[model samples]
Target: MGTRWTISTPEPLPADAVDAVDAEIDRIDRAWSRFRDDSMVADMARQAGRYPIADTDQPLVDWYRRLYDLTGGAVSPLVGQTLADAGYDAIYTLRASARVPVAPAWDAVIGEHAGALELREPALLDVGAAGKGFAVDRVAEIVGDSFDDFVVDAGGDMVISPRSRGLRVALEHPSDATKAIGVVSVAGGAICASASNRRVWADWHHIVDPRTASPAREVLATWVIAPSAMEADGLATALFFTPAAFLRGDFDHHREGFHHVTIRRNGSVEHTAIPGLELFL
Candidate 1:
Protein backbone atom coordinates (compact mmCIF):
# COMPACT_ATOMS: atom_id res chain seq x y z
CA MET A 1 0.00 0.00 0.00
CA GLY A 2 3.05 2.29 -0.21
CA THR A 3 2.04 3.05 -3.79
CA ARG A 4 -0.79 5.19 -5.16
CA TRP A 5 -4.06 3.87 -6.56
CA THR A 6 -6.31 5.43 -9.19
CA ILE A 7 -9.93 4.51 -9.80
CA SER A 8 -11.74 5.56 -12.96
CA THR A 9 -15.39 4.91 -13.56
CA PRO A 10 -18.18 6.31 -15.69
CA GLU A 11 -19.30 8.29 -12.62
CA PRO A 12 -17.43 9.55 -9.59
CA LEU A 13 -17.36 7.39 -6.50
CA PRO A 14 -19.57 8.62 -3.65
CA ALA A 15 -17.91 10.07 -0.55
CA ASP A 16 -18.89 7.24 1.78
CA ALA A 17 -17.94 4.63 -0.78
CA VAL A 18 -14.54 6.26 -1.18
CA ASP A 19 -14.04 6.11 2.56
CA ALA A 20 -14.95 2.43 2.57
CA VAL A 21 -12.44 1.76 -0.21
CA ASP A 22 -9.66 3.51 1.67
CA ALA A 23 -10.45 1.56 4.82
CA GLU A 24 -10.29 -1.74 3.02
CA ILE A 25 -6.85 -0.93 1.56
CA ASP A 26 -5.54 0.10 4.96
CA ARG A 27 -6.81 -3.18 6.42
CA ILE A 28 -4.87 -5.17 3.85
CA ASP A 29 -1.70 -3.14 4.39
CA ARG A 30 -1.80 -3.74 8.14
CA ALA A 31 -2.21 -7.47 7.62
CA TRP A 32 0.71 -8.02 5.22
CA SER A 33 3.15 -5.12 5.47
CA ARG A 34 6.57 -6.34 6.55
CA PHE A 35 7.72 -2.72 6.86
CA ARG A 36 5.19 -1.91 9.57
CA ASP A 37 5.61 -3.04 13.14
CA ASP A 38 1.87 -3.23 13.74
CA SER A 39 1.50 -5.67 10.87
CA MET A 40 0.91 -9.30 11.77
CA VAL A 41 3.43 -10.41 9.11
CA ALA A 42 6.11 -8.13 10.52
CA ASP A 43 5.51 -9.46 14.01
CA MET A 44 5.56 -13.06 12.84
CA ALA A 45 8.78 -12.50 10.93
CA ARG A 46 10.33 -10.70 13.86
CA GLN A 47 9.54 -13.62 16.13
CA ALA A 48 10.69 -16.06 13.37
CA GLY A 49 9.74 -19.37 14.85
CA ARG A 50 6.14 -20.22 15.60
CA TYR A 51 3.02 -18.08 15.38
CA PRO A 52 -0.66 -18.49 14.65
CA ILE A 53 -1.50 -17.94 10.99
CA ALA A 54 -4.31 -15.55 10.27
CA ASP A 55 -7.23 -16.31 8.00
CA THR A 56 -5.96 -13.64 5.62
CA ASP A 57 -2.64 -15.46 5.27
CA GLN A 58 -4.39 -18.38 3.61
CA PRO A 59 -4.88 -16.66 0.27
CA LEU A 60 -1.28 -15.50 0.22
CA VAL A 61 0.01 -18.93 1.16
CA ASP A 62 -2.16 -20.74 -1.34
CA TRP A 63 -1.12 -18.44 -4.17
CA TYR A 64 2.53 -18.73 -3.24
CA ARG A 65 2.31 -22.51 -3.27
CA ARG A 66 0.73 -22.54 -6.71
CA LEU A 67 3.21 -20.01 -8.09
CA TYR A 68 6.18 -21.82 -6.62
CA ASP A 69 5.13 -24.96 -8.43
CA LEU A 70 4.26 -23.17 -11.66
CA THR A 71 7.53 -21.34 -11.91
CA GLY A 72 9.56 -24.14 -10.37
CA GLY A 73 10.51 -21.90 -7.44
CA ALA A 74 11.28 -18.93 -9.65
CA VAL A 75 8.52 -17.03 -7.86
CA SER A 76 9.02 -17.69 -4.19
CA PRO A 77 7.53 -16.21 -1.03
CA LEU A 78 10.35 -17.66 1.07
CA VAL A 79 12.76 -15.13 -0.49
CA GLY A 80 11.67 -12.45 2.00
CA GLN A 81 14.84 -12.78 4.04
CA THR A 82 16.84 -12.92 0.83
CA LEU A 83 15.35 -9.59 -0.17
CA ALA A 84 16.21 -8.15 3.23
CA ASP A 85 19.70 -9.48 2.96
CA ALA A 86 20.09 -7.74 -0.39
CA GLY A 87 19.38 -4.35 1.28
CA TYR A 88 15.61 -4.17 0.75
CA ASP A 89 14.81 -4.19 4.42
CA ALA A 90 12.04 -3.21 6.82
CA ILE A 91 12.39 0.47 5.99
CA TYR A 92 12.81 0.10 2.21
CA THR A 93 16.47 1.04 2.32
CA LEU A 94 18.60 -0.19 -0.57
CA ARG A 95 22.15 -1.32 -0.07
CA ALA A 96 24.99 -3.04 -1.92
CA SER A 97 24.90 -5.90 0.54
CA ALA A 98 24.47 -9.42 -0.84
CA ARG A 99 23.94 -12.29 1.49
CA VAL A 100 22.20 -15.63 1.07
CA PRO A 101 19.51 -15.71 3.71
CA VAL A 102 18.78 -18.77 5.79
CA ALA A 103 16.25 -21.05 4.16
CA PRO A 104 14.38 -22.75 7.01
CA ALA A 105 12.83 -25.14 4.52
CA TRP A 106 9.33 -23.78 3.99
CA ASP A 107 8.09 -27.34 3.44
CA ALA A 108 9.27 -28.41 6.88
CA VAL A 109 7.57 -25.44 8.52
CA ILE A 110 4.29 -24.74 6.69
CA GLY A 111 1.53 -27.34 6.57
CA GLU A 112 -1.56 -28.66 8.29
CA HIS A 113 -1.18 -28.82 12.02
CA ALA A 114 -3.32 -29.69 15.04
CA GLY A 115 -5.57 -26.63 15.37
CA ALA A 116 -3.65 -23.74 13.77
CA LEU A 117 -1.21 -23.31 10.89
CA GLU A 118 2.28 -22.10 11.68
CA LEU A 119 5.51 -21.04 9.98
CA ARG A 120 8.24 -22.77 11.99
CA GLU A 121 10.99 -21.27 9.90
CA PRO A 122 12.26 -17.68 10.03
CA ALA A 123 10.60 -17.17 6.64
CA LEU A 124 9.40 -13.62 6.14
CA LEU A 125 6.78 -14.56 3.54
CA ASP A 126 7.14 -12.01 0.77
CA VAL A 127 3.93 -11.90 -1.27
CA GLY A 128 4.98 -9.07 -3.61
CA ALA A 129 4.48 -11.34 -6.59
CA ALA A 130 0.72 -11.26 -6.46
CA GLY A 131 -0.22 -8.91 -3.62
CA LYS A 132 -0.87 -5.87 -5.78
CA GLY A 133 -3.03 -7.74 -8.28
CA PHE A 134 -4.88 -9.46 -5.47
CA ALA A 135 -5.46 -6.10 -3.84
CA VAL A 136 -6.74 -4.69 -7.12
CA ASP A 137 -9.27 -7.52 -7.27
CA ARG A 138 -10.30 -7.01 -3.66
CA VAL A 139 -10.65 -3.25 -4.04
CA ALA A 140 -12.94 -3.74 -7.04
CA GLU A 141 -15.37 -5.26 -4.58
CA ILE A 142 -15.73 -1.81 -3.05
CA VAL A 143 -16.98 -0.40 -6.33
CA GLY A 144 -19.33 -3.41 -6.54
CA ASP A 145 -22.08 -3.37 -9.15
CA SER A 146 -22.60 0.36 -8.65
CA PHE A 147 -20.85 1.34 -11.86
CA ASP A 148 -21.46 -0.18 -15.27
CA ASP A 149 -17.73 0.02 -16.03
CA PHE A 150 -14.60 0.81 -13.99
CA VAL A 151 -10.85 0.45 -13.86
CA VAL A 152 -8.52 0.20 -10.90
CA ASP A 153 -4.85 0.92 -11.45
CA ALA A 154 -2.56 0.15 -8.53
CA GLY A 155 0.86 1.41 -9.58
CA GLY A 156 0.24 0.18 -13.13
CA ASP A 157 -1.18 -3.23 -12.22
CA MET A 158 -4.87 -3.19 -13.15
CA VAL A 159 -8.34 -4.68 -13.17
CA ILE A 160 -10.78 -3.37 -15.76
CA SER A 161 -14.47 -4.11 -16.05
CA PRO A 162 -15.83 -3.05 -19.40
CA ARG A 163 -19.47 -2.98 -20.28
CA SER A 164 -18.95 -2.95 -24.05
CA ARG A 165 -15.43 -2.34 -25.33
CA GLY A 166 -12.13 -3.72 -24.12
CA LEU A 167 -9.40 -1.51 -22.64
CA ARG A 168 -5.97 -1.01 -24.17
CA VAL A 169 -2.90 -0.60 -21.92
CA ALA A 170 0.55 0.54 -22.94
CA LEU A 171 3.48 -1.60 -21.91
CA GLU A 172 6.25 0.52 -20.45
CA HIS A 173 9.95 -0.05 -20.77
CA PRO A 174 11.39 -1.93 -17.84
CA SER A 175 14.28 0.49 -17.32
CA ASP A 176 12.57 3.67 -18.44
CA ALA A 177 8.98 4.21 -17.45
CA THR A 178 8.44 7.03 -19.95
CA LYS A 179 9.05 4.94 -23.03
CA ALA A 180 6.51 2.34 -24.04
CA ILE A 181 7.26 -0.93 -25.80
CA GLY A 182 3.76 -1.81 -27.02
CA VAL A 183 0.08 -1.71 -26.19
CA VAL A 184 -2.24 -4.53 -25.20
CA SER A 185 -6.03 -4.77 -25.21
CA VAL A 186 -8.09 -6.33 -22.45
CA ALA A 187 -11.86 -6.41 -22.43
CA GLY A 188 -13.07 -7.63 -19.05
CA GLY A 189 -10.47 -9.03 -16.70
CA ALA A 190 -7.14 -8.32 -14.99
CA ILE A 191 -3.73 -7.37 -16.41
CA CYS A 192 -0.62 -7.59 -14.26
CA ALA A 193 2.85 -6.43 -15.25
CA SER A 194 5.93 -7.31 -13.22
CA ALA A 195 8.99 -5.21 -13.90
CA SER A 196 12.56 -4.88 -12.66
CA ASN A 197 12.39 -1.22 -13.66
CA ARG A 198 11.60 0.05 -10.18
CA ARG A 199 11.89 -0.76 -6.45
CA VAL A 200 15.62 -1.14 -6.95
CA TRP A 201 18.49 -0.12 -4.73
CA ALA A 202 22.24 -0.38 -5.06
CA ASP A 203 23.00 -3.14 -7.56
CA TRP A 204 19.82 -5.15 -7.15
CA HIS A 205 16.16 -5.03 -8.12
CA HIS A 206 13.05 -6.30 -6.33
CA ILE A 207 12.49 -9.51 -8.32
CA VAL A 208 14.45 -12.45 -6.95
CA ASP A 209 14.85 -16.13 -7.85
CA PRO A 210 14.56 -18.36 -4.79
CA ARG A 211 16.42 -21.28 -6.30
CA THR A 212 19.67 -19.35 -6.89
CA ALA A 213 19.06 -16.55 -4.37
CA SER A 214 19.55 -13.89 -7.04
CA PRO A 215 17.58 -11.63 -9.31
CA ALA A 216 16.05 -13.11 -12.46
CA ARG A 217 18.07 -11.64 -15.30
CA GLU A 218 16.56 -13.13 -18.44
CA VAL A 219 13.36 -11.13 -18.82
CA LEU A 220 13.10 -7.52 -17.78
CA ALA A 221 9.33 -7.45 -17.53
CA THR A 222 6.30 -9.68 -17.99
CA TRP A 223 2.57 -9.01 -18.49
CA VAL A 224 -0.17 -11.58 -18.03
CA ILE A 225 -3.95 -11.65 -18.43
CA ALA A 226 -6.08 -14.01 -16.44
CA PRO A 227 -9.62 -14.52 -15.14
CA SER A 228 -8.70 -12.92 -11.82
CA ALA A 229 -6.29 -10.22 -10.76
CA MET A 230 -4.69 -12.53 -8.25
CA GLU A 231 -3.98 -15.13 -10.94
CA ALA A 232 -2.77 -12.55 -13.40
CA ASP A 233 -0.47 -10.99 -10.84
CA GLY A 234 0.90 -14.34 -9.70
CA LEU A 235 1.41 -15.60 -13.24
CA ALA A 236 2.95 -12.34 -14.44
CA THR A 237 5.71 -12.71 -11.88
CA ALA A 238 6.11 -16.32 -12.88
CA LEU A 239 6.27 -15.26 -16.52
CA PHE A 240 9.45 -13.41 -15.68
CA PHE A 241 10.96 -16.84 -15.17
CA THR A 242 8.62 -19.16 -17.07
CA PRO A 243 9.38 -20.32 -20.58
CA ALA A 244 7.00 -19.68 -23.46
CA ALA A 245 6.55 -23.42 -24.05
CA PHE A 246 4.86 -23.92 -20.71
CA LEU A 247 1.84 -21.78 -21.54
CA ARG A 248 1.29 -23.55 -24.87
CA GLY A 249 1.66 -27.02 -23.47
CA ASP A 250 -1.30 -29.40 -23.74
CA PHE A 251 -3.92 -26.90 -22.59
CA ASP A 252 -6.61 -25.65 -24.95
CA HIS A 253 -6.31 -21.96 -25.67
CA HIS A 254 -9.93 -20.90 -26.11
CA ARG A 255 -11.94 -22.49 -23.30
CA GLU A 256 -9.14 -21.97 -20.75
CA GLY A 257 -6.62 -19.45 -22.01
CA PHE A 258 -3.59 -17.46 -20.83
CA HIS A 259 -1.67 -14.80 -22.75
CA HIS A 260 1.81 -13.52 -21.93
CA VAL A 261 4.01 -10.69 -23.19
CA THR A 262 7.60 -10.68 -22.06
CA ILE A 263 10.14 -7.94 -22.58
CA ARG A 264 13.73 -9.03 -22.61
CA ARG A 265 16.73 -7.19 -21.25
CA ASN A 266 18.04 -6.54 -24.75
CA GLY A 267 14.97 -4.52 -25.74
CA SER A 268 13.16 -7.30 -27.59
CA VAL A 269 9.64 -8.53 -26.95
CA GLU A 270 8.37 -12.12 -26.91
CA HIS A 271 4.64 -12.65 -26.97
CA THR A 272 2.66 -15.79 -26.34
CA ALA A 273 -0.68 -15.38 -28.02
CA ILE A 274 -3.85 -16.68 -26.40
CA PRO A 275 -3.76 -19.43 -28.98
CA GLY A 276 -0.14 -19.23 -30.23
CA LEU A 277 3.38 -18.20 -29.17
CA GLU A 278 5.80 -15.91 -31.01
CA LEU A 279 8.20 -12.98 -30.65
CA PHE A 280 7.30 -9.51 -31.82
CA LEU A 281 9.24 -7.38 -34.29
Candidate 2:
Protein backbone atom coordinates (compact mmCIF):
# COMPACT_ATOMS: atom_id res chain seq x y z
CA MET A 1 0.00 0.00 0.00
CA GLY A 2 3.05 2.27 0.36
CA THR A 3 3.78 2.22 -3.34
CA ARG A 4 2.72 4.06 -6.50
CA TRP A 5 0.09 2.69 -8.89
CA THR A 6 -0.80 3.16 -12.55
CA ILE A 7 -3.93 2.49 -14.61
CA SER A 8 -3.39 1.82 -18.32
CA THR A 9 -6.13 2.01 -20.90
CA PRO A 10 -6.35 2.71 -24.64
CA GLU A 11 -7.56 6.23 -23.86
CA PRO A 12 -7.22 8.52 -20.89
CA LEU A 13 -9.76 7.72 -18.22
CA PRO A 14 -12.47 10.24 -17.41
CA ALA A 15 -11.83 12.48 -14.41
CA ASP A 16 -14.71 10.93 -12.47
CA ALA A 17 -13.46 7.45 -13.25
CA VAL A 18 -10.02 8.31 -11.88
CA ASP A 19 -11.63 9.82 -8.80
CA ALA A 20 -13.68 6.71 -8.20
CA VAL A 21 -10.52 4.59 -8.32
CA ASP A 22 -8.77 6.92 -5.87
CA ALA A 23 -11.72 6.77 -3.49
CA GLU A 24 -11.72 2.98 -3.52
CA ILE A 25 -7.98 2.87 -2.74
CA ASP A 26 -8.49 5.19 0.21
CA ARG A 27 -11.35 3.03 1.47
CA ILE A 28 -9.25 -0.13 1.38
CA ASP A 29 -6.31 1.61 3.09
CA ARG A 30 -8.52 2.78 5.92
CA ALA A 31 -9.85 -0.74 6.38
CA TRP A 32 -6.67 -2.80 6.09
CA SER A 33 -3.52 -0.69 6.35
CA ARG A 34 -1.33 -1.58 9.35
CA PHE A 35 0.80 1.54 8.82
CA ARG A 36 -2.07 3.87 9.67
CA ASP A 37 -3.02 4.28 13.31
CA ASP A 38 -6.65 5.05 12.42
CA SER A 39 -7.01 1.97 10.25
CA MET A 40 -9.50 -0.75 11.27
CA VAL A 41 -6.71 -3.27 11.71
CA ALA A 42 -4.91 -0.91 14.07
CA ASP A 43 -8.09 -0.64 16.11
CA MET A 44 -8.28 -4.43 16.23
CA ALA A 45 -4.72 -4.49 17.59
CA ARG A 46 -5.64 -2.20 20.45
CA GLN A 47 -8.21 -4.51 22.03
CA ALA A 48 -9.55 -8.03 21.79
CA GLY A 49 -13.19 -7.95 20.79
CA ARG A 50 -15.68 -8.82 18.11
CA TYR A 51 -15.11 -6.25 15.36
CA PRO A 52 -17.56 -5.78 12.51
CA ILE A 53 -16.36 -7.01 9.13
CA ALA A 54 -17.44 -4.96 6.12
CA ASP A 55 -19.02 -6.86 3.25
CA THR A 56 -16.31 -5.57 0.90
CA ASP A 57 -13.63 -7.07 3.11
CA GLN A 58 -15.27 -10.49 3.25
CA PRO A 59 -13.19 -11.75 0.30
CA LEU A 60 -9.97 -10.62 1.93
CA VAL A 61 -10.91 -12.33 5.21
CA ASP A 62 -11.84 -15.49 3.35
CA TRP A 63 -8.58 -15.46 1.42
CA TYR A 64 -6.56 -14.97 4.59
CA ARG A 65 -8.32 -17.91 6.18
CA ARG A 66 -7.68 -20.12 3.16
CA LEU A 67 -4.04 -19.07 2.78
CA TYR A 68 -3.29 -19.60 6.47
CA ASP A 69 -4.52 -23.18 6.27
CA LEU A 70 -3.13 -23.85 2.79
CA THR A 71 0.38 -23.00 3.86
CA GLY A 72 0.02 -24.57 7.33
CA GLY A 73 0.31 -21.21 9.12
CA ALA A 74 3.33 -20.08 7.09
CA VAL A 75 1.31 -17.16 5.73
CA SER A 76 -0.55 -15.17 8.36
CA PRO A 77 -2.03 -11.79 9.17
CA LEU A 78 -0.81 -12.40 12.75
CA VAL A 79 2.76 -11.47 11.69
CA GLY A 80 2.04 -7.73 11.99
CA GLN A 81 3.57 -7.61 15.46
CA THR A 82 6.53 -9.65 14.32
CA LEU A 83 7.16 -7.28 11.41
CA ALA A 84 6.90 -4.28 13.73
CA ASP A 85 9.35 -5.80 16.21
CA ALA A 86 11.72 -6.57 13.35
CA GLY A 87 11.76 -2.84 12.47
CA TYR A 88 8.94 -2.62 9.89
CA ASP A 89 6.46 -0.73 12.02
CA ALA A 90 3.75 1.90 11.64
CA ILE A 91 6.23 4.82 11.74
CA TYR A 92 8.66 3.05 9.40
CA THR A 93 11.24 3.15 12.23
CA LEU A 94 13.29 0.41 10.58
CA ARG A 95 14.75 -0.29 14.01
CA ALA A 96 14.48 -3.78 15.39
CA SER A 97 13.30 -4.45 18.91
CA ALA A 98 15.62 -6.01 21.51
CA ARG A 99 13.72 -9.25 20.96
CA VAL A 100 11.08 -9.99 18.37
CA PRO A 101 8.24 -12.30 19.29
CA VAL A 102 7.19 -15.25 17.17
CA ALA A 103 3.76 -14.88 15.59
CA PRO A 104 0.89 -16.73 17.25
CA ALA A 105 -1.07 -19.29 15.27
CA TRP A 106 -4.27 -18.01 13.59
CA ASP A 107 -6.67 -20.21 15.55
CA ALA A 108 -4.96 -19.32 18.83
CA VAL A 109 -5.58 -15.60 18.42
CA ILE A 110 -8.40 -14.88 15.97
CA GLY A 111 -11.73 -16.26 14.77
CA GLU A 112 -14.73 -15.31 12.65
CA HIS A 113 -18.18 -15.35 14.24
CA ALA A 114 -21.54 -14.07 13.05
CA GLY A 115 -20.24 -11.49 10.55
CA ALA A 116 -17.61 -10.27 12.97
CA LEU A 117 -13.92 -11.01 13.54
CA GLU A 118 -13.43 -12.16 17.12
CA LEU A 119 -9.99 -11.66 18.55
CA ARG A 120 -9.06 -13.63 21.64
CA GLU A 121 -6.14 -11.28 22.24
CA PRO A 122 -5.13 -7.92 20.83
CA ALA A 123 -2.89 -8.48 17.77
CA LEU A 124 -1.74 -6.47 14.80
CA LEU A 125 -3.07 -7.87 11.54
CA ASP A 126 -0.93 -7.28 8.45
CA VAL A 127 -2.43 -8.07 5.04
CA GLY A 128 0.42 -6.84 2.84
CA ALA A 129 0.75 -10.26 1.25
CA ALA A 130 -2.50 -10.05 -0.69
CA GLY A 131 -4.31 -6.83 0.20
CA LYS A 132 -2.68 -4.94 -2.64
CA GLY A 133 -3.64 -7.55 -5.18
CA PHE A 134 -7.19 -7.62 -3.93
CA ALA A 135 -7.23 -3.86 -4.25
CA VAL A 136 -6.00 -4.22 -7.82
CA ASP A 137 -8.83 -6.56 -8.68
CA ARG A 138 -11.35 -4.18 -7.20
CA VAL A 139 -9.87 -1.28 -9.11
CA ALA A 140 -9.92 -3.36 -12.29
CA GLU A 141 -13.59 -4.07 -11.82
CA ILE A 142 -14.25 -0.36 -11.48
CA VAL A 143 -12.20 0.35 -14.56
CA GLY A 144 -13.87 -2.47 -16.45
CA ASP A 145 -17.26 -0.84 -16.00
CA SER A 146 -16.12 2.13 -18.12
CA PHE A 147 -13.60 0.58 -20.46
CA ASP A 148 -13.56 -2.74 -22.28
CA ASP A 149 -9.87 -3.30 -21.54
CA PHE A 150 -7.40 -2.04 -18.96
CA VAL A 151 -4.41 -2.99 -16.81
CA VAL A 152 -4.10 -1.99 -13.17
CA ASP A 153 -0.54 -2.05 -11.88
CA ALA A 154 -0.12 -1.60 -8.16
CA GLY A 155 3.65 -1.49 -7.86
CA GLY A 156 4.60 -4.88 -9.37
CA ASP A 157 1.36 -6.70 -8.58
CA MET A 158 -1.12 -6.38 -11.43
CA VAL A 159 -4.50 -7.36 -12.92
CA ILE A 160 -4.88 -7.35 -16.67
CA SER A 161 -8.31 -7.28 -18.24
CA PRO A 162 -9.02 -9.18 -21.43
CA ARG A 163 -7.33 -7.50 -24.41
CA SER A 164 -7.11 -8.16 -28.12
CA ARG A 165 -3.37 -8.73 -27.72
CA GLY A 166 -1.66 -9.75 -24.49
CA LEU A 167 0.82 -7.54 -22.69
CA ARG A 168 4.49 -8.63 -22.40
CA VAL A 169 5.77 -8.16 -18.84
CA ALA A 170 9.42 -8.26 -17.83
CA LEU A 171 10.37 -10.14 -14.68
CA GLU A 172 12.96 -8.05 -12.85
CA HIS A 173 15.97 -9.77 -11.35
CA PRO A 174 15.67 -9.94 -7.59
CA SER A 175 19.27 -8.91 -6.96
CA ASP A 176 19.58 -6.33 -9.73
CA ALA A 177 16.60 -4.23 -10.63
CA THR A 178 18.33 -3.08 -13.82
CA LYS A 179 18.34 -6.57 -15.28
CA ALA A 180 15.36 -8.67 -16.26
CA ILE A 181 15.44 -12.41 -15.69
CA GLY A 182 12.57 -13.23 -18.03
CA VAL A 183 9.33 -12.13 -19.66
CA VAL A 184 5.77 -13.37 -19.66
CA SER A 185 2.74 -12.66 -21.82
CA VAL A 186 -0.36 -11.92 -19.81
CA ALA A 187 -3.64 -11.79 -21.69
CA GLY A 188 -5.94 -11.51 -18.73
CA GLY A 189 -5.99 -12.31 -15.02
CA ALA A 190 -3.46 -11.41 -12.29
CA ILE A 191 0.30 -11.58 -11.81
CA CYS A 192 1.89 -10.85 -8.45
CA ALA A 193 5.52 -11.00 -7.33
CA SER A 194 7.34 -11.00 -3.98
CA ALA A 195 11.05 -10.66 -3.23
CA SER A 196 13.39 -10.38 -0.23
CA ASN A 197 15.42 -7.54 -1.75
CA ARG A 198 13.20 -4.60 -0.86
CA ARG A 199 12.61 -2.90 2.52
CA VAL A 200 15.82 -3.97 4.26
CA TRP A 201 17.33 -2.88 7.55
CA ALA A 202 20.15 -4.46 9.52
CA ASP A 203 19.78 -8.12 8.42
CA TRP A 204 16.00 -8.04 8.13
CA HIS A 205 13.51 -7.62 5.28
CA HIS A 206 9.75 -7.27 5.09
CA ILE A 207 8.92 -10.89 4.24
CA VAL A 208 9.14 -12.57 7.64
CA ASP A 209 8.54 -16.27 8.14
CA PRO A 210 5.90 -16.47 10.93
CA ARG A 211 7.18 -19.88 12.03
CA THR A 212 10.55 -18.42 13.14
CA ALA A 213 9.80 -14.69 13.52
CA SER A 214 12.57 -14.17 10.96
CA PRO A 215 13.00 -13.19 7.37
CA ALA A 216 12.60 -15.94 4.83
CA ARG A 217 15.98 -16.60 3.19
CA GLU A 218 15.57 -19.80 1.24
CA VAL A 219 13.94 -18.20 -1.79
CA LEU A 220 15.12 -14.83 -3.09
CA ALA A 221 12.01 -14.12 -5.17
CA THR A 222 8.72 -15.62 -6.33
CA TRP A 223 6.12 -14.89 -9.03
CA VAL A 224 2.63 -16.27 -9.40
CA ILE A 225 -0.21 -15.98 -11.94
CA ALA A 226 -3.80 -16.76 -11.07
CA PRO A 227 -7.38 -15.91 -12.00
CA SER A 228 -7.45 -13.14 -9.41
CA ALA A 229 -4.76 -10.79 -8.17
CA MET A 230 -5.65 -11.74 -4.60
CA GLU A 231 -4.87 -15.37 -5.24
CA ALA A 232 -1.70 -14.57 -7.16
CA ASP A 233 -0.45 -12.18 -4.49
CA GLY A 234 -1.16 -14.56 -1.59
CA LEU A 235 0.35 -17.49 -3.46
CA ALA A 236 3.49 -15.49 -4.33
CA THR A 237 4.25 -15.02 -0.63
CA ALA A 238 3.15 -18.56 0.28
CA LEU A 239 5.63 -19.93 -2.25
CA PHE A 240 8.39 -18.50 -0.06
CA PHE A 241 7.53 -21.12 2.59
CA THR A 242 5.57 -23.83 0.72
CA PRO A 243 6.57 -25.70 -2.39
CA ALA A 244 4.56 -25.28 -5.61
CA ALA A 245 3.74 -28.98 -5.87
CA PHE A 246 2.10 -29.07 -2.45
CA LEU A 247 0.02 -25.98 -3.19
CA ARG A 248 -1.11 -27.37 -6.52
CA GLY A 249 -1.98 -30.74 -5.07
CA ASP A 250 -3.68 -29.46 -1.95
CA PHE A 251 -6.03 -27.05 -3.73
CA ASP A 252 -8.10 -28.41 -6.58
CA HIS A 253 -8.30 -25.08 -8.46
CA HIS A 254 -4.60 -24.41 -7.94
CA ARG A 255 -3.72 -27.47 -10.02
CA GLU A 256 -4.91 -25.68 -13.16
CA GLY A 257 -5.45 -22.03 -12.26
CA PHE A 258 -1.99 -21.20 -10.89
CA HIS A 259 1.54 -20.99 -12.29
CA HIS A 260 4.71 -19.97 -10.44
CA VAL A 261 8.47 -19.36 -10.63
CA THR A 262 10.90 -19.12 -7.74
CA ILE A 263 14.52 -17.97 -7.47
CA ARG A 264 16.37 -19.74 -4.68
CA ARG A 265 19.28 -18.66 -2.50
CA ASN A 266 21.61 -20.97 -4.43
CA GLY A 267 21.05 -18.90 -7.62
CA SER A 268 19.05 -21.72 -9.14
CA VAL A 269 15.67 -21.20 -10.77
CA GLU A 270 12.63 -23.42 -10.25
CA HIS A 271 9.35 -22.91 -12.09
CA THR A 272 6.21 -24.51 -13.45
CA ALA A 273 6.14 -25.11 -17.20
CA ILE A 274 3.64 -22.56 -18.42
CA PRO A 275 3.30 -21.43 -22.03
CA GLY A 276 3.50 -17.66 -21.46
CA LEU A 277 6.65 -17.57 -19.27
CA GLU A 278 10.17 -17.50 -20.71
CA LEU A 279 13.40 -17.32 -18.66
CA PHE A 280 16.72 -16.13 -20.02
CA LEU A 281 19.01 -17.76 -17.46
Candidate No. with top lDDT: 2
Tens digits of per-residue lDDT, candidate 1, 91-120, equal 866874545664344576566522344666
Model 2: residues >4 Å from true position, as ranges? 254-256
TM-score against truth, every candidate: 0.88, 0.96
- Steric clashes per prediction: 0, 0
Tens-digit per-residue lDDT, 133-190, candidate 2 = 9999999988998898889999989999877677899999999999999998888889
lDDT of each: 0.74, 0.90
Please list the residue runs of candidate 1 whose C-alpha ends up more than 4 Å from where it truly belongs after superposition.
48-57, 102-104, 113-116, 247-254, 274-281
For candidate 2, what is the total of clashing residue pairs?
A: 0
TM-score of 1: 0.88
After the best TM-score superposition of candidate 2, give how far the Cα of residue 192 lies from its true spot, in angstroms. 0.5
How many Å off is the CA of 267 in candidate 2?
1.5
